[model samples]
Target chain A: GQQVMQIPQYQHVQEGEDFTTYCNSSTTLSNIQWYKQRPGGHPVFLIQLVKSGEVKKQKRLTFQFGEAKKNSSLHITATQTTDVGTYFCVSSHQAGTALIFGKGTTLSVSS
Target chain B: GAGVSQSPSNKVTEKGKDVELRCDPISGHTALYWYRQSLGQGLEFLIYFQGNSAPDKSGLPSDRFSAERTGGSVSTLTIQRTQQEDSAVYLCASSPPANEQYFGPGTRLTVT
Candidate 1:
């Protein structure tokens, strides 16, 4: 079975601090998707990385895909209270199949 | 342009009873998926439907779990003889072709 392992099951940081979450796997991945789920809310699509060693940015957030394509990381700078939520890393082997999700890293920011 | 929608935001059923959860995907989406999430746990794959193709039920935990997609639009998940362990939040997501998925609010099921 394929699995994505995310580090730091939970993290608490100050509002102005930076945070990072990593997702790794023993097997090569075709693509990786990141999602955010607020408390009592559904998962929302954040970004997707497909190419190896690719790096994409969304405002204060940066997503990077490892050269081997088996790992990915999400880094957020100057975290805000709105950043509090669980971040999940997702991957799928083929189209039209179920997405494999990581355990997710819950982020809490205190102002 | 409404997103995915699910019914019965919350449900409480007695042990050994059966329950049905509903999901309505966005118009024209060709793929739909179901997942379960327990408290403080990650999303667990359940089932997937793609257009008119045979659904992938490999993720189903038990025969007690079943799902059907009607007319490539709506879907329903049926759980029979529910047990206390059946308690969790059931989420439905729909995607167009190979794009990102749009998730519904999910249905919380509690079996007593």
Candidate 2:
């Protein structure tokens, strides 16, 4: 069975601090996707990394896929109150199949 | 276009009662999925539908849980004789092949 594990199950930081969550998979993944779920909101797609050693950035957020394609990381800089939510990493052998999700890292920022 | 829509935003039911949750996916999407998220827990894959292929039900917890996608658009998940432990949020998502999934606001089911 395939499994994705995310570290730092919970993190709380000052409003101006940076945050990072790591994800590791037991099996090689075709691609890794990142999502954010605001409090009481549905998960929303943030970004996806398909190539090994790929890196993509969205404003203050940066996503990276390991060269082996089995791991990934999401980093956020200068967190804001609006960034308070659960960050999840999901992967599948290929798309159009059920995605295996990592135990998300819940981020809490306090101003 | 609608992202995704789910009915009965919240549900409260007594134990042993049967319940059904519905999900309407974005039009033109051929893949649909169901997932469960318990309080303070991660998302659990339940099932997946791709185009006309048979759905993958290996993630279903038990025979008590079943789901079907009608016309490749709307989906329904049914739980027979639900138990208190069945309380959780049911989420539905749809995506194009090899693309990111778009989720619907989940239905919260509370089994008393």
Candidate 3:
């Protein structure tokens, strides 16, 4: 069974601070996707990376995939109160059969 | 152009009872998935269905859990003889052509 492990299970930061969460897998992944779940809300699709060593930016959020395609990271700079939620990194099997979700990093921002 | 939708936003049942949750994936989407999220936990994959392919139920925790997709549109997840540990938010998601995944609001099930 393949498992995606995320670091810093929980993160709390002051407004305007930075936050980052890392994800790793024991086996290589064909691609990886990121999702965000607001408090008491359903998970929403954020972004996806398919190429090796790919880097993408969406506003203040930055996503990177490892060259080996076994790890990924999400970094948020100058976080805002609206950034309070859990970020999850998910990967699918080589055949795209099942999706493996990471435990997620819950981020809390206080103004 | 609507997103996925789930029925019975919340449900309460007693132990040893049976419960069914429904999911309506976006129109024309061929890939549907079922996931469970316990309190303060991440999404746990339960099952998957592709266009006309046999479902993959490898993530099912026990024989008590079962799901079905009819006509390749709607899906229903049934849990028989539910236990208190079964209380959790059952989420449904669908991806078009098997790529990015979009999730539904989810059904919050509580077993007493």
Candidate 4:
């Protein structure tokens, strides 16, 4: 069985500060996906990375996949109160299989 | 519908009772998955179904838990003789082959 581990189980930052969360796995992964779950809401797909050493950016957020395919990270620049939520890293061996989810990093931003 | 839909957004049952949760995936999606999340916890994989293939039930926690996908469109998760430990939020997600998943609002089950 593969396990996805995430760091900083909880993060608190002031508005305009930066935040980052890391994800690692014991085994190699075919793809890594990031999701965000707001309080009292379902998890929503954010982005996915497939290639090694891949980096993708969305507005103020950046996602990176490590060269070994066993690690990934999400960094948010100048965080805002709206960025408060749980960010989860998920992975699956294949496209349509069950995904292994990390415990998630819950981010709290104070304005 | 436009997205995955789950029925009975919330459920409350007594210990030793049985409960069935329903998940209606997005139309035309070939894969459906079930996950459980306890309070302040991560998502726990429960089961997976891809098209008409046999479901992957390796994630089921115990014999009392089971699930079925009917006609490859809808799914039902049944928990027989539920215990207090069964209290958690059950989430359903659907995806087209090799695509990102769309999640439903989930069913919050509380066993008293």
Clash pairs for candidate 3: none
Q: List model 4 lDDT by residue over B3-38, tens digit each.
A: 999988999999999999999999999999999999
Per model, kept true contacts as a fraction are 0.82, 0.91, 0.82, 0.88
By DockQ, the candidates rank as 4, 2, 3, 1
DockQ of each: 0.74, 0.77, 0.76, 0.78
Give the per-residue lDDT of model 2 (tens digit) for A22-102. Answer: 999867898999999988888899998999999999999999999999899999999999999999999997655667778
Q: lDDT per residue, candidate 4, A1-111, as tens digits?
A: 366999999999999999999999877888999999999898999999999999999999999999999999999999999999999999986656777789999999999
**Clashing pairs for predicted structure model 1, backbone only:** none
Clashes of 1: 0
Docking class of 4: medium
TM-score of chain A of each: 0.96, 0.95, 0.97, 0.95
| lDDT (Cα, 0-100) at A37 in candidate 2 | 91
The positional error of residue A70 in candidate 4, measured at the CA in angstroms, is 0.9
Clashes of 3: 0
Q: What would the per-residue lDDT of candidate 3 be over residues B1-112, giving only the tens digit for each residue?
A: 7999998999999999999999999998899999999989998989999999999899999999999999999999999999999999999999975478889999999999
Per-residue alpha-carbon lDDT of candidate 1 for residues B41-94, written as tens digits (9 for 90 to 100): 889989989888899898899999999999999999999999999999999999
Model 1 misplaced stretches (Cα beyond 4 Å): none
